[model samples]
Target: MTPSTAEHPQMSVEDFEDLARHAPETVTLEFINGKLEVKPVPDGDHVTIFMWLLRQCMQARPDLDLHPEQGLKVGTYRNGRARPDGALGPVGHFAGQGEWADPAGVLMVVEVTSHDSGTDRRDRVEKRDGYAEAGLPVYLLIDRDADAVVVHSAPRDGRYAEITAYAYGATVTLPAPLGITLETEGLKDYSL
Candidate 1:
């Protein structure tokens, strides 16, 4: 966790949300670990990867919807706000819910890495912790930089206790509740 001075976040979470609300449409904002981060607009390859995964999820679990770029309240206190590339949940799970919906029934969050300076901390560390803290069942990181698929699951005590990485051609089995097997050879076409 990023330490705060005087136990004060750079700005209150509420303040961050207000600032985010007024930010320009081109700007994507995320508050993680008491810090504000501008998420880079995804590149073509990033979008392609997400779309590819979206199809897989839809085919495997027709009952669930893989929502694109959905805002979510993360962290144990719901203080952190994150807009994941895709949030998988039961159909209509976000209905009647406002912009920043609670993460309660969200089964999995997917993040396709953007080639950016902040991808390491933003996707691999801070956001992972935030999603884990929210007690979501799964976190899937399609790491373009590493050419690997990382599955984060088994959230326990504000962190994911089980993390596994698979190579591009490997078949990865997402655990129960999200029991979909991914044939990741298709990912290689999008890799650098």
Candidate 2:
């Protein structure tokens, strides 16, 4: 059975982390406002699009490092932290910073939107704000059902001023840090 975004009783971040540590591997938890929300894994289309996008980035710049679904802490005072679908960073970006690189230094962040209502809202709204507030320059959203990719950039005063969308067959140009024109053909046959 798939995980649902049911309301979880309020718990501190530490509590959430502790629970997550012992949680079964089959489950994925995302903390929101001190509550742990179970996030269902992505469907076929979501993974397909994500892999294609990652491949594009890898092919364009072999030196770049692209990580899938890694936890990252952002926002001032770590008010909000999340594990995005994919995050791009320079080679050795975390050389002396340990395994996880600082979210503030991330080059790009991508979220593969799920069908769940709460997941969709969090990906489209909450994350957008969180990433912006952390000053992440580029944010990408791959909407499966919509069969579209949304790119957000140009953070001004802790908000994204430029938002664009591209459907299949369209070349989506990303902003700086993740500069690349993704061809639509590769992402066309995905379930989205």
> What's the TM for model 2?
0.85
The C-alpha lDDT values of all candidates are 0.91, 0.74
Clashing pairs in 2: none
User: Clash number for every model?
Assistant: 0, 0
- TM-score per prediction, in order, is 0.95, 0.85
**Residues 33-126, candidate 1, lDDT per residue (tens digit)?**
7778899998888998898898999999999999998999997588888999999999999999988999999999999988888899889998
Error of 1 at 64 (Å): 0.3
Q: Any runs in candidate 2 off by more than 4 Å, and if so which? A: 1-9, 94-101
User: Candidate 1 local accuracy as lDDT?
Assistant: 0.91
Task: Compute the lDDT of residue 20 as modeled in candidate 2.
Answer: 70
Residue 51, model 2: lDDT of 85
